[model samples]
Target: PVVSDFKILKNAGVQEKESFHPLRWFSLEQNYPNPFNPTTTIRFKLPNRERVWLAVYNSLGEQIRTLTLNTLNGGTHTIVWDGTNDIGKRVQSGLFFFRLQTKEGALQRKMVLLR
Candidate 1:
């Protein structure tokens, strides 16, 4: 469902300069409960507004899930994985990698799931 109404604004003869500072890009944090079961949380920080993609890969280097977010504002955001694959089926206990991709770059972290 559409949540917000689109708005149109007239140009105010001003263009905001994109910051080249280190803080302008996005960042990813390690998943909590390093060794998780059923579920886990992943936190990230987007210092500047932009689109992003979060994905999960198995130990065999095959993608298991892909999460895409539309334009998001700059700041911290959190997402959760229920230890399931893209098809909504539970995955086996093993090592997995979760990666956050953005126009700026990509970040990945390792996690373990216990049955």
Candidate 2:
């Protein structure tokens, strides 16, 4: 059975984060420390509740990792990558792409991992 968990309690009663620091539009920020070693932070902003999927790919276009996350709220969110693949194997230094997809569209950004 596929299980979906929602943290309604925490999100409940909380106003949209964008209202406080509103986003001009939906966006995906470039990973910080672009040429990162073993780890990096990826940030994005949403305008509404939606199912968000994020994945990492190698320069050859093969999916290497999936950053597991639940349904997201309309606001900014941070995701961390540890330079590992789905099987927990450490990847070597090179160029990679992080793809964030929603019903609206998919945003893909390039990043580098330096070992």
Instruction: Write candidate 1's Cα lDDT for 15-58 as tens digits.
Output: 88996565756789999988998899999999888889899999
Instruction: Write candidate 2's Cα lDDT for 33-75 as tens digits.
Output: 8999878999999898888889999999999998955688999
Local distance difference test, each candidate:
0.88, 0.87
Worst 10 residues of 2 by lDDT: 1-10
- CA RMSD of each candidate after superposition: 16.2, 16.9
* Candidate 2 wrong stretches, greater than 4 Å: 1-24
**TM-score quality measure for candidate 1:** 0.77
RMSD of candidate 1 to true structure, Å: 16.2
